[model samples]
Target: MSLFSLENKTAVVTGGASGIGEAISKAFAGQGAHVHILEFNAENGERVVGEIKAKGGKAKFHACDVSNNVQVTEIISAIGTQSYINILVNNAGIAHVGNLEGTAEEDMDRIYNVNIKGVYNCMHAVISKMKEKGGVILNMASIASSVGISDRFAYSMSKGAVLTMTYSVAKDYLDNGIRCNSISPARIHTPFVDGFIKKNYPGKEEEMFEKLSKSQPIGRMGKPEEVANLAVYLCSDEASFITGTDFPIDGGYIKLNG
Candidate 1:
């Protein structure tokens, strides 16, 4: 048997309309899983589903705002009615760039709603159902989750919650045949990165990109596919022994940078 094959499994991937989430969704679908994308971007979500279907993979898109518990719950409930959910990738999140002094209360609240509470919302909606037959959950954390990063107070706070949540859920559900974990990626080269550079640095976009890449200590930024590959492995049955862990696909950023 192929160790990483997700054959006959059903995966729900939040934020799957773009970037790392998109890569994970496609990777899971390619591995024979029925992918359900819970995304806020209706157009992108539909397009992704179409692309996956055209490639002969099973996929569906649900327009969902992870911060909205009512909407999230309703969508998950509807999905549960059709398939036995096996995996959930909590990748829906927003980014904020500011230190504590620079961060306003509104910034903190916005980050909290989407990053911290959003993960909770999705996990809460799916846990009881997953308990019935066992499942895997992978949360998209960041290097900010564990270490200090300048100009990222709100983002860091939210990801810290994600890390702890992974541990708490893993411990609480030990007997339920559920495995929970988080992935912390540093400086991934997603379109979001490019856009941030373009909007913030403009003429210095390439300069900023290089600086960000070098910050990782690997002399380059990570690819979304690299993160997705790890997600695929962690979600597969081969990783049944893993739980309550935070895997940093950081290109040595966390350990080597200092």
Candidate 2:
């Protein structure tokens, strides 16, 4: 059997409704893993699940506001009892464009709640279960984690914590066979990009999109499936010896550009 095979495994992806999260969910299902999507958006979540099912993949939906501990704990616990949570992908996050001086207190709190605390909550809820079963954890960090991006003060802060948390968790659980890692991606073409364009650029949406796409040295944004392919590799047995590291799937933005 290929080390990439996920035949007997199960993966839980928060924010599995769209973007990179959607791609990861579908890819895991394609690898023969049972995928359960936890997302705040029921409509998009159901749509993704439907697509997976149509392809004869195994998947389900769980409505979630990952920032809410009570909700995350209760739902994850219920799911844990039925089957071991083998692989957990913490992909639930939001982006904020503001520096320290321009960012609002409310906005900072919101970013911390959903971006930082949200990952913490879900990890806390499932870590013990994962330890018992010796599973994998993949966090969706960003280039903001290591390098400063313009007007991303709060976003950068949260992602830095994510990268560290990946290391911290992986270190603490090394003896238990639990592995944790993070993926830092540069700009990717997703609904969020479209929405940002529509809301901010309006008539100049295409122009702004092209600008964002070219921000990467590779001259284009990444596709969700590309990110997903890397994720599937990291979570599979092939990466069993790989952990405590952050994989930058960015288009040479971190190194080549520098």
Candidate 3:
């Protein structure tokens, strides 16, 4: 048997429209899983599903806002009717750049709603169904989850919650055969990064991009596919013995940097 083959499995990937989430969606589909992408961007979501189908993979797109509990539950419940969800990748999140003093109360609230509550809503919506059959849950965390970073107070706060939630769910569902884990990645080279640099740095975009990439000890930003590869392994039955762990795909940013 192929080590990471996902044949006959069904996967639900939140925020599977772009970047790391998109990479994961494609990787899972390539491995023979039926992927259901829950995303807020209708265009990108539909595009991803269409591309997957064109490649002879099964994929469906659900227009969803993960921060909305009612919407998340309703969508997930609808998906449950189709198949037993075997893998869930919670990759939906927003980023904020600010220290405590710089962060507005509204900013904190917005981050909390999507980053923390979104994870809770998705997990809560699926846990009961997952309990009936063994499954894997992977939450996309950040290096900020464990270590302090400059000007990311709100983002850090939400990710810290994510790491703990991962631990809690893994412990709570151990007997039920649900494996929960998190992936903490540092700066990843994505279109979002490029857009951010272009919008903020303008003529200095390349300089800022290089600076951001060099922040990691590995000397360059990690690739989305690199993170997706680890995700695939974790979600596979080959990793059945693993649970309640946070795998850092941070390009040595968490430890070696210091």
Candidate 4:
């Protein structure tokens, strides 16, 4: 059998319309799994599903807001009724760039609702269905989840929750054959990063981009496809012996950056 092949599996990927989530959705489908993309952006969702289909991969898009429990539950339930969900990639999260004093109540609440609670909502909605036939869960954590990143109070807090939730779920569902793991990425090069630089740094976009890229200690930002490749391996049956682990896809940031 080919390594990391997900043939006949049914996978759900939240925020699958863009960035790392988009890469994971395409990769999963390319490996023979039917992908269900849960995304808030209908335009991007349809575009991604179209791209996947164009590549001869099976994919469907569902208009979803991961932060809304009712919506998440209904969507997952409907998908579960149609097919057994063998893999779930919780990649729906938002970022905040602020320290404690810079963070406002609304800012914290917004981060909490999407980053932390969204993970909970999707996992909660799918756990029972996965319990019936065993499945893999991959949460998109961050370097902030483990290390202290300056000016990221709220973002770090939310991701810290994601990291711990991965552990708790992995431990709790072991007997049920559910394997849960998290990927802690450093700076990943995405459209969001470009926009963040353009919005925050203005004319110094190139300067700020280089600064952010070099912060990873490898002199570059990670590619979404690289992270998606790791996601594929972890979700595949070859990784059956692994569980409750946090895989840092940081470019030497976690260990080498001092």
Candidate 1 clash pair list: none
The alpha-carbon lDDT assigned to residue 116 of candidate 4 equals: 94
The candidate 3 region of ten consecutive residues with least summed lDDT is 249-258
TM-score of candidate 3 to 2 decimals: 0.99
- True-structure lDDT of candidate 3: 0.96
Tens digit of per-residue lDDT, candidate 4, span 202-236: 99999999899988889999999999999999999
Per-prediction CA RMSD (Å): 0.7, 0.9, 0.7, 0.6
Q: lDDT (CA) for every model shown?
A: 0.96, 0.93, 0.96, 0.96
**TM-score-best of 2 and 3:** 3
Clashes in model 2: which pairs?
none
Which regions of candidate 2 fall more than 4 Å away from where they truly are?
A: none
Residue 30 lDDT in candidate 1: 94
TM-score of each prediction = 0.99, 0.98, 0.99, 0.99
Candidate 1's C-alpha lDDT? 0.96
Residue 156 local lDDT, model 2: 97
Residue-wise C-alpha lDDT for candidate 2, range 1-258, written one tens digit per residue = 876999878889999989999999999999999998999999999999999999999999999999999999998998888788899999999999888999999999999999899999989999987877699999999999998799999999999999999999999999989999999999989989899999988899889988988889999999999999999999999999999999999899999875
Tens digits of per-residue lDDT, candidate 1, 73-151, equal: 9999999999999999999999999998999999999999999999999999999999998999999999999988999
Question: Model 4, stretches more than 4 Å misplaced?
Answer: none
